[model samples]
Target: MYASFFGLSQDPFSIAPDPRYLFMSERHREALAHLLYGLGGGGGFVLLTGEIGTGKTTVCRCFLEQIPADCNVAYIFNPKLTVGELLQSVCDEFGIPHGHNGPGEETAKDCIDPLNAFLLRTHAAGQHNVLIIDEAQNLSADVLEQLRLLTNLETNERKLLQIILIGQPELRTLLARPELEQLAQRVIARFHLDALSLAETEHYIAHRLAIGGRHGALPFDRAALQLVHRMTHGVPRRINLLCGRALLGAYATGQSVVDRKIVAKAGTEVFGDLPAARSAGHPKAVAAGLGLVAGVALLAGLGWAMGVKLPWTGASPTAASSAAGPHIAAARPAASQASAALAATATAAATDHFADLFTTLPRAEDAAWRALAADWKATPDAAADPCEALPAQGLQCFRSTRTSLALIRQLDRPGLLTLTDAQGRPAYALLRGLDARNATLLVNGQPRAVPLATLALYWRGEYATLWRTPPLDDRLKGEKARAAATAQWVSQQLATLPGVATPASGAAAGDSPRERIYRFQLAQGLVPDGQAGPITLMLLNRATGVAEPQLQK
Candidate 1:
C-alpha cells in the first residue's frame, strides 16, 4: 500500500541473501579476506568461525565467486559422517570409482591410490584443489584424523591436499582438544567473523534497500535504524527479518511515509508489548470540539447557499464591491488565526502526548548507570570501572567513549530487544522469539548454531565482551595461553606424523590470498607480483602440497 503512495516500485526490505544485496561490513570484509587467503594458501588448513547468523556462509559464497577458473573446489555443506563415509563422500565428490565388493582396507587403498595419482597428475598439469567443509564442527575426532591423513599424500616440498573448515565456535573447541593438536597446528590461517556494528547495521539496511530498488528516501528513518541496530544487536539476519516485517506493516496500513507510529505497530505485532498509547486530555477535547464546529458551519453554509441564484452583471459595481469586500476581509484574519491556533494546539498536544507516553512506558532500569554514578560519588578514581556490581546472566554490557551501561535481556531467546531514546517512546517493536538447541540458535523460522569451538575462538577476539569482572590484561593473557596450548599440540602431532613432511620456512606468512599468491609466485620463480592466475595458484598448491580438486561426473 505504501509503494504507490511513496512512488516506489517494489518492497525495499527483504530477508533473502541476494548477492546483489550483500553489504560488506568491516568484519564481513575481513572474514571474506581470511577465507580467500585460506583458499589461495594451497596447503595446510584454513579455519573460519563465527556466531550464528554472522554471515559466514554468505562470506564463503562471496569467496567462491572470486576463485580462479582453474581452481577445483569441493564444498561439503554437511559434515556429519563416519570416517569411512567421509572418504567415500570425498571419492564421490571427485568422481573416483568405488567398487561394491571389497575388504574395507582394499577399498580404502583403491580410493587413496587413484586420489594420490590424480593429485600428482594435477600438480604436473598445474591446478589448485580445495576441499571446503562447512559445519565442520560436526566432524568426529576420527573423521578429523582421517582428514589429517589425507594431507599425508605429498611430495618433498609440500603436502598434497588443502582443507578449509568452516563452522560455528564449536569447531574451534574440537580442534583445541589435546587429541586434535596436529590438526590445529596445520591451520595456516584462521579468522573469527563477528556481527556488524551499529553504523554498519545502518549501511546494511540502506544497501539492501538500494539493491531492492529503493532509489530515493525509503520507509526506514534514522530512529528506526537505531532501533533496528539495538534490537538485532547488529546481526544481519535478524535485522533483515525485522525490517521486512516493518515494511509489510507500513504497506498494509496504506501509509505513504513510514514513521515511528507505523514502526511501533509493526513491532508490537511482530515482537510483543505495544507502547502505551497517550491519554487524550482537555486540549484534545477542545480541538475536537472546534473541528466539529468548523465542519458544521461549512456544511450549513453550503446547504443554505445551494440553488440561490444571483446575477453578477446586474448588481451595482459599488454594491458588489462592498458585498465582496466585507466577506473577503472578514474571512482572511479569522481563517488565518483559526489555522494557526489549531496547528499550535495540535503541536502542543502531540508533544505532550508523546512525552507522557514515554514517561509511562516500561524502561530498562538504569541500575547499572546509577551504580557507576554512586561509585564515582563515593570515590572519583573508582568510577573508571563500571561492571562492579552488574549481574552475570542475561546482562549484555558495553563500555564505549560516551556511555557504559548493562543491556538487560528484556526478551531472551531469539527475539528483538528494542531500545528507544530515554525521551522517545517506542515507535516500533519487530522482534521474533526463537527456541535453541545445543549447537544452534533458532532465527526467524530456522534453526542455526555454530560449532562450540567456533564460539570459543570468537570469544578470544578483542570484540568479544565478557560478563565477568576479570582484569582486561588477565583475560588477554588467558586467551593467549589457550591459543598457545592449542597451537603447540597441533605442531607436535603434525611433526610426528608418519608420511607428511613439514612445509619450508615462509609458508604461511601472508595475510591475504593475494599475498599468498605472491609468495607462491616467488617460490616458483614466476613474477613476484601477487596476481594469482590459474598457473600461479596451481604452482602454489604444488609447492604447498595441496591436492588438485576434481569434480564428480
Candidate 2:
C-alpha cells in the first residue's frame, strides 16, 4: 500500500527469501565462497550455520542457482524425522521408488539399499549428487548417522553423495557433541555467518530499495539510517520489520521524507519502549507546519517559470513566491559554487546547455535505461525492464550509492546519474561522455555538455551502470576449482600490467593469489577485500581489453 506513495515499484522490505534481493556484503560473499568451496571438496559434508534470519537460506538459494547441470540435488527443509522417514523423504525428492509402508513398517536397510543403488548408477554415469538438509539442528542423532553412512557409498575416488547441513548456530553445538565427532570430522568446509555491520546494513537497505525500483534520494535521512542499524542490531529480519513499519508510518503521516523522529516512533511501535532520540522531542504538529512552509518555499523557488511543467503532479504553481523569493536569492550562490573552479568556468555555454536539458528532461526512469542500452549497441525488449532483459545479451546491472566522480572515472564506463533538478526532484540522465572540464549527458534523447562544476551542483552521486561479463569456462560450476582457475586468470592478467613482476611461485612462496588480488585491488582503488567479485572482475576485463564498450572521451 505504501510502495507507490514512496515512489517504489514494490514493497522493499518483504521477508521472503528472494535471492534477487540478497546483498552481497563482504561476509555474505565469504559465506557464499565457502559453500562454493565445498562443491569441489571431493564429496564431504559442507556445514553452514548462522543465527536465525541471518540469511543462510537465502545464500543457499543463490548457491543452488549456480549448481552445475551434471549435479542432482535433493533438498529437505524439515529435518525433524526418524531415519526411515528421512530416507523416505530423500527418496521422494529424488523420485526414487522406495516402497514400504510408513516409518514403522520399514527397516532402514530397505530404504538405504535403493538409495545406494541409485547413487552408484549416477556416479558411474559421471553425475554428482548433493543432499541439502535445512534446519539440520533438529535432526536426530540416528538420522545424522544414517546421513553419514550415505556418504560412505563410494567409487575408488570420491564419496558418491555430498551432504550440506544448514541450520541455526545450535547446529554447530549439536555437531560438537561427543557422539557426533565422526560426523563433524567429515565436514570438509564450514562457515558461520554473522549479522551485518553498520555499513553493510546501510548498503543492504539501499540495495533493496534500488531493486524495488526506488527512484531519487532515499526516504530515510542519514541519521535515521544509522539509528536503524542501532535499533535492529544489524539483523536483517529486524531491519526489515522496522523499515517496513517506518515507511508505513511516514505514509500515514503524509510525509515524503522519513526523518529520525519517524524512525524512532516506528521502532517503538515495532519494538516496544525504545526511546526516541533526544532531539526528536518536538511536537509533530509544529514539525508538520514547518514542513508545509518549507515545501511551498522549495517549489516556488524551483524556477519552473522557465516554462517546464510539472509532469508527475500536474499541480498549478503556488502563489507563495513572495515568501520564497528571499530564500532562493540567498541559496543561488551556495548552490552554484559547489566547486569553486567549476563555478568559475560556468559560462553562458554551460548555462544554455542546462536550460535545454531541463526543458526537455525525461520524466520516467526507464528513459535513462534506454539511453544506456543504446551506448552498448543493444536493443532491449520494449515490454521488459532493461536490466532484466539485457542479461540475455550478457550484461548485468550494478547500482551503488555514496559514490564519487573519481571512482566513475576509474571504472571508465558510461552510466546513469541520479540528479536533483531545479524543482528538487529526482532526475536521471545518461552519462555517455566525460572529461575533466565537462560531462556530456543524454537528457530527453538529446546530448548536452555541461561543465563538471555545474554538474556537481545537481548530482549527489547515485549511479547505476551496466557491465559485461566475459563468457565462463567449464570451471564455472565448481566453487574451489573455479577459485583456483580464477586466481590463475588473475595472475595471468596481472602479468600484462606495466611494471608488475612476473607472478613467480606466488601461492607456493607465501605471496598468495589472494594477497596479490588484495594489492591489485588497493592499487585500483577498490575495497581490497582480496575477493575477485564482479567489480574486480570487470576491471580485470577492462584492463585486459575484453571487447566491451568504454565511456566516451
Candidate 3:
C-alpha cells in the first residue's frame, strides 16, 4: 500500500527470501563460506544454525545458486518426519525407487539400499551428491540417527553422500546430546549465523530499499534506523515487519519521512501492549509507550559494544561502504612502509589497544581495510567497491573463512581479522604484526599488541588480505596469445626459487608450467593444485620481490 508513496518499485520489506535482496553481511558471508567449504570436504555433515529469521534459509538459497554443475543436490525444507518418512522423502527427492515391490510394506532397509545404489552410481560417474535438510531441529532422534547412518555409504577415499543440516540454535544443542555424539563427530564444518549489528542493520535496510528500487535518500533517518535495530534486535525478519508497517504508518499519517515517532507508533501496533514495550517511564525509553524500544543510540553505545567506530568520527559513508571489501587484501611488510618512529609508536599503542582512542575511528572492517590499503600505498577508489577497484591497481583481494592464524603467519602479511566482540557481534581488526606470543592488531588503525591467547578468544580464523597481482595474471585465463608468455614467466619465477631446477634449453621436456606451479606450491605450503591461483600467485609475488605489504615479525 505504501510502495508508491515511498516511490519504491516493490515492497522493500517483503519477508520473502528473494536472492536479489539478500544482504551478504560479514556473518552471512562466513555462513555461505562454510557451506561452500562442505562441497569439497569429501562428504560429511556441514551444519548451519541460527536464531529464527536470522537468514539461514536465505543463505541456503544463495548456496543453492552456487552449487557446481557436477554436484547433485537433494534439499528437504521440512524435517519433522519419522525415520521411514524421511528416508522415503530422500528417495523421492533423489528419484530413487523404493518402498514395497511385493505385498508387504517396505522397511527402512528398502530405502537405504536403493539410495546407496544411486549414490554409488553417481560416484562412479564423478558427480558428488549433497542432501540438505532444513529445519533439522524438529528431526527426531531416530531420524537423525538414520541420517547419520546414510553417511556410512562411502568409498575408500571419501563418503559418497554429503549431508547439510540447517536449523536454529536448538539444532546445535540437539546435536550435543550424548546419544548423538557420534553424529556430531562427523560434522566437518559448522557455523552459527548471528544477527546483524546496527551498521549491518542499516546496510540491510538500505540494500533492500535499493533492490526495491528506491531513489535518493532513505525515508527513514538515522534515528529511525537506530530505533528499528533496537525494536527488531537486528533480525532481518523483524526489521522487515517493523519497517514495512512503519512505512505504512507514514503513508497513512501523510508524513514524508519516518522518524522515531512513526517507528514507535508502528512498534506499538506491531508488538502491541507487550510487557516489554510497556515498561514505566525510563530515561532510556524515548516515550512512555516505547518501553520495548531500545534506548541506547547506535553510534556510541553500539560502537563500544562491538569495538568499532561510527560516522561521528569524521569518516564518511564511502569509507563505511568498503567495510570488509569484497576481495581480501594481502598482509605483509606492513611496517616496511611506515617510518621506524611511526611503527614503534603503533607497536607501543598495541598494549593500550582498546583505549579511548579506539572509539574515534571508522567501523572495524573499514579501518582494517583502510589500514591495509595505507600499508600497500595503493589508492582504491573510496566511492567504489574495493574488491572491484583494487584489481585496477595490479592488486588482488583474497578472502577465506577457513583460514587460520597459522596460515596468516605463513602468508607473512598483515590482513583483516574477524573477531567476536563483547556483544557477540562480528568485529574487524587489521593484523599488522605477529610473533610467537604476541600479535599486533591495528584496531581502529592503531597498533595494539595482544597475546595470542587474547586474540584467540575473539578471532575464529576468518581473514581477508590483498596481494599484488602477477604480471602474468591476465594471461592465466587461457588466452592463447599469452600462453607462451605465461609459461615463460612461471618457469623463470620457479627456476629462481629453491629446489626447482632451471631448464638448460629454451624448454625442458615434461617440464610444463603446471608441474612447476605444483612444485612451487609444495615448497610454499599452499594447496598444490597445479593451478596458479591467487594465493599461489601471491606467494610467487612475495618470493619474486613484487612488493606488497609485510607483517612485522
Off by over 4 Å in 3: 273-553
lDDT of 2 at 123: 85
Q: Scored by Cα lDDT, where does model 1 land?
A: 0.52
Residue-pair clashes per candidate: 27, 0, 20
- Report, for every candidate in turn, its global Cα lDDT versus the true structure: 0.52, 0.72, 0.72
lDDT tens string, model 1, 1-553? Answer: 2233333466555556677666666566556666666654558888999887889888888878988787777788889887777877787776667654554454566667777887787777777778899999899999999899898888885666788899999999999999999988888778888888876676576556655555334345556666666666777877776676666543332222344443444444454442321111243433443333244334433533684322211233233223434542332244433443454355346445434433333343232233323322322223334344333221223332211011111111111123343443332111222211012322223333422222221121111121211212224357677555534433333334332233445554424434544444433434334664433433333344443221111
**1-553 in candidate 2: lDDT tens per residue?**
5676666889999998776687665566567767765666568799999887788888888788878899999999999998888999998888788776666677777778898999999989888889999998899889988888888888887888899999999999999999999988889768898998876787677668867877444666667888898888888988999898777655433345566666776776677655443335554533453344345434423624454332222211121112335542232233222332242234435655575676566667787788788888888898999989997787888888766665677678898898876678777888878875568887656677776645655776699988885554754768777667667777888777753333323222445666566555545545456788878877887877977777778
Superior candidate under TM-score, 1 versus 2:
2
Clashing pairs in 2: none
Tens digit of per-residue lDDT, candidate 3, span 389-466:
887887778899867455676678878877764567666777889875567987544577775534554565689999
Q: Show the lowest summed lDDT stretch of 10 residues, model 2.
A: 313-322
Rank the candidate models, highest TM-score first: 3, 2, 1
Q: After superposition, how far is residue 529 of candidate 3 from its true place, in Å?
A: 10
Model 3 root-mean-square deviation: 17.1
lDDT: worst 10-residue window of model 3: 324-333
Error of 2 at 118 (Å): 0.6
